[model samples]
Target: MPGLAGTERKNIAPGLAVSIVLKQDQRTGKLTEGVVKDILTKSPHHPHGIKVRLETGEVGRVKEIHDEE
Candidate 1:
């Protein structure tokens, strides 16, 4: 799913890798890849994307979830 509404918390664990769209890159629809450090979205679903903080300290909405291996 491109948006976070279809994603579940279990599917996006803290150590999982993911591609997200940062605030600065939202206009270009750029994707930043990083390991999830924290899940900021408390709601069950969001229309835009699930807000999360990466290990690198970058915060954005998850666009795609990637496997660790």
Candidate 2:
């Protein structure tokens, strides 16, 4: 929890635990927690956050990467 989660592409990877904001939830700033199944963002950085697919088959933009717990 000490380290920061960057929107840069290098900061996210498959199998990492992360919190993402789904398209519908963006207005409310909702966060969904799940293990990353894939990185959907093609760019090196995104202002809104990197898009990704979770293990649960949900796709969204990563808001924060969860530290090992």
TM-score per candidate? 0.84, 0.91
Clashing pairs in 1: none
Residue-level lDDT of model 1, residues 1-69, one tens digit each, is 543332565566788789999999999999999998999989877767788999999999988987545
Off by over 4 Å in 2: none
List per-candidate RMSD values in Å.
Answer: 2.7, 1.5
Error of 1 at 65 (Å): 0.4
Q: lDDT (CA) for every model shown?
A: 0.82, 0.89
Candidate 2 per-residue C-alpha lDDT over 32-69 given as tens digits, one digit per residue, 9 for 90 to 100 = 99999989999999989999999999999988888886
